[model samples]
Structure formats: C-alpha cells, structure tokens
Target: MKDMVTPTMPVFEDMLAAHDRIAPHIHRTPVLTSAYLNGLSGAELFFKCENFQKAGAFKVRGACNAVFGLDNETARRGVATHSSGNHALSLSYAAGRRGIPCHVVMPRTAPQAKKDAVRGYGGLITECEPSTSSREAVFAEVQAATGAEFVHPYDDPRVIAGQGTCSRELIEQTGGLDAVIAPIGGGGMVSGCCLTLSRLGPGTLIFAAEPEQADDACRSLRAGRIIADDAPETVADGLKVPLKDNTWHFVSRHVTDILTASEQEIVEAMRLAWQRMKIVIEPSSAVALAAILKNPEIFRGKRVGVIVTGGNVDLDRLPWSAG
Candidate 1:
C-alpha cells in the first residue's frame, strides 16, 4: 500500500472559511441543556446537538466542505471514501445535493442501519472486511476505477477544518466554557475541537473520550505516539478507526486529556440521554457523556460542552436490548 499523503494542518482561518462555505448546506445545530444530566454529572453540560444535524451526524459538516470545495472538473468524477457509517452517508448526502456520484467502501460488518442510510443517500457501496487494511484496499480500487476525488473520513485537512466549526458554534452558544469533550475515533472531531478552542476558547480545556475496549487514542496519548488497533470491538462503532497524522497533530498538542468509558457505561449513557435528555444519540456520541459520568471530579463545577456527535442508531438492535 502507498503512503497516504498528509494534507497541511488546518488553521483557525481554514475553519472559519469552512464554516462560511458549508453554512448554506448545514444546520447551525442547536445547543441543548439537560437539568437532569447536569445534576447527575455535577456539571453544567451543554450538549451541542449534531445528532440533529443533516445526514444525522456531525460528519456532514466535513463531508459537505470536501464535496462542495471541489473544482468542477474534479467534482465531475465525483468523490469516494471508506467509512464505517456516518462519513459515508454524509458524503453521499453532500454529493447528492451536488448531483455527483459518491462511492463508498464500507465494512461488511458495519451496522445495517448505517449501510441502509448510506444507500438511501444514493451512495454506491462496496463492502470490505472490518479492518483498516481491508477498508483502504477496497477504497483504493474504488477510487482508481472511478477516478473520483478521495475524501478521507477524518484525516484530511478539509475534514478537520469543517469539524472545527462545531466548537466555534459551541463557544458562541455558551458564553465561555471551562471544558469541552467529544468522542475520538480517527480524532477528527476531537482534533477539530482542539483546532477551534485552542484559538477561540484558549482557556477552555479540551478532552477526548473513548471506549475502554478501543482505547488506542488514550494509550497513544500516554505513550506519546500513535498506537493503532486494526479492529477493536466496541458499541461505539463510529470510533473504531485509529488516528492519522493530521488529526494526531492537533490532538497531541491541544487536547488536555484522553478519557475512556466501558462498553456498558457507553450504553447506559446513550440510554440516559434518550430517557432524560429526550434525544437520540448513537453510542459514539454517548462516550463523552459516559466519561463525564464516570469521572465527575474532572467535570464537576465546570461549565462543560459535550458534543452529541450523531443520532443515527440501529433501532432493531439497541445495545441495551437482549439478542
């Protein structure tokens, strides 16, 4: 396999540009507060509800930016990417808006709901084994065959800049936050938070949440280098991938800590949000909340921003339900 080229690190200006470019396509998703969750976590939690976003996830912000920023010639051939779910559907949604072909390389084992959503968004799917190697290999073939522009799920600078816009809105929604937390997979959202907050909310502490079963990001932070796991089993399907250089650049520098929650804790958080907060958030989004609940001392007494990354769930297979 050839080395993936690392795009230049995105700056605050790039995030601003991305926000302006994608605003027409994306909703300025609301920030909601839950008194029950606040009382439980002992912190003033503001949930930036990207779950209500277009394509049902925060990935749309990045996907739209990448898809729309393409030149006419490049876009004529359309776009291609490999994602477990959210990014795939998001890119498809964006491409559909532009009336372009969107090819997706998805894991054969990815949630059926996500796969269905991707197809519903008009993305052409080619299934691969649920591993980084298989995903990349399949995506390479798709890209070559179609001659489409490649839009990496989290690693690309365009995607990171687009994701950073979420924090920009969060800082604006809440006057000033003491801290902010979001789930980390390939670290796009966390890196984006770091990118935006490091410049705008310089005083705000940034944290990345992860599942203990897939704690590569936490381990990498402690080890002072990237430690990738090929395929880790966790309920937070969106967080299975490992960090790339571009995302690692921001995460390593600006994130204050990497926290983790167990699988049961993640499911509980997801259920708690649905029951108490009256919102539908996927397991990946719940990791931040679970970490806050698990380590109240870290968030207590602080006005914290919790990114509700996405709402997409496989209703037929709720994690808390018995098989």
Candidate 2:
C-alpha cells in the first residue's frame, strides 16, 4: 500500500467532533455480517449498514453535522446545497431538524424519487443543468437570491469530518479489518473513511471502488490531478462528480487502492444482494460488492469491510441486468 499523502491529514479530530455534535441526530447504524456473503467473496465481510441510516443513507451524518454545527447566525440565514438526491434529502432533513429552511439545487436529470424525497422533507428545489461547472453557477444564484449559506456536497472540511464518523463507527464495530472498501463518487465517504482509518486503524487497507464508466477517481489518483468528468454516463447517479481538490488531497494521502467495476458487475451485485441478502442497495453502494465480486483475488484472503452506503435505489427503474 502506498502512502496517499506526504503528511497524514488531520481529519480525525474533526470527525470526533462531528460524532459528538451530530450524535443525537444521526443513527449509529448497525454493522451486519453475512456468512453467505463472506463465503461467496472468499473473505470475512463486515457490511457497515449506512443504507439503514437516517435519510436512508450516510449523507445525513455529514449533512447533519454541517447543518447543526453552524453558528446560530448562519443557521438563521438558512442553508443551500446541490445534490443528485441523497444529499438533498439529507440537507432537507437536517435543516428540518434545526428548524431552518433548506434550498437544494438538483440536476433536472436527478432521480424522481430523490427529488420527491427532497420535497417530502420540505426542501425547496431549484433544478439546474446536470454538469458540475454549471451546478456551481446555479447554486451561486440560488444562494445569492435566497441569502442562504452553502453546504458543499463533498469538498468541505465540516462535511468530510461528519462523514468520517461512519467509518469510525464501522472500525469500532468490526475492531480488525485487513482492508476496507468504499464506493467513491464525489469522495465524501472515502475521504472521511480514509481519515479515520489512517489515524485510528493505521494498518487497514483503504480501497476505493468506482464505476468503470465513471472512473474519474481512479484516473485522478493515478494522475495526482483532478480530472473533469466529461459527458459521464452511469447507472449510479450518485457517483457522478469529478474528483474535488480536497477529496483528491485526502485520496493521495490515505487510499490504498482504487478499483473499477463494470456496469454489468454492478447490476449483478445489486440484484444478488437484493434477492439473496434481501438488502436493497443503490448502484453507488453496490460498487463495493461489484468490485469484490469481479476481483476476488485482491480481497479474497483479507478481512474486508464494505460500506453498504445507501439503500435509496428508486426501485422504479432498475439497472441493466445479466440477462
């Protein structure tokens, strides 16, 4: 495993603070182990079930911490963010908890369920062009028009610290993991997960699982640069962002490896998990299982931990299948 950074980043203390700040709002989600999944993957597998988290995904942790940890004046001004789905819902829920209004800038192409969730949670939605470059412009307009504070999706220290608490709880629950694999999109989960493991569980190999079509993180890590995701296409709508500087900054320091999984592999893994394990996993989260299934040798003999990061698959439309 290569050191992803010259100096280990100090994200753990903030994660600890996040754990304390958002403790009452966030769920200490359970760590589930599957004898069948372990045997199938040829490794002892511990699934940190954030799919069961508040907002039905791990986004709420960061969203809650970032929302609640804000000073009263900032909270009073309200908050705004851009997301495909989970982040919007999480932001809405977190803001609702704090008695503040949330403005969510979502891609028009974002899942209808996610859009509905945002509205269901009382979020005010402003639809935008799905591109990263334009989303910022749209958010800026919304923030200015609404006079709302911005809560960045993945690149903020506060949000990243909040996300780290998920992995912290996972490490605490499992105790010893030879390797931990998390699916990466915008790098929030991996950034935080890496920070926690680097500090508390130093020996844990942190692997990032990414969709092959949306393999920007793999490219960014290899090139040590942030690559734009030009005309990206993937079933994992959540894993759409190009790597952020802060995310890549942490990736360079803590990630042990970046693995790519095919669309077919991702779909099959999602189906199998739902049918066999009865776990409804989103395509982004299913990337972890997909990677394990496709390249078993890399993880076969190791004690591996995977974040079943979310369960918010729209259930209306399905991913491409093996048949």
Best by TM-score: 1
| lDDT per residue (tens digit) for residues 238-261 in model 1 | 899998899889999988999999
lDDT of 2 by residue, 1-323 (tens): 01211133345788898999999998899888778888898988889999999989999998998899889987998998876578888999999999999998889987677788889998999888878677878988887787787777777777888899998898889887899999998899999988888888899999999999999999988887888787689887688787776688788888988999888888888887887777888989999998998888999889998999899866557775324
Cα distance off (Å), candidate 2, residue 137: 4.2
- Kindly give the stretch of ten consecutive residues in candidate 2 with the minimal lDDT sum: 1-10
What TM-score do all the candidates reach, one by one?
0.95, 0.92
CA displacement after TM-score superposition, residue 253 of candidate 2 (Å): 1.2
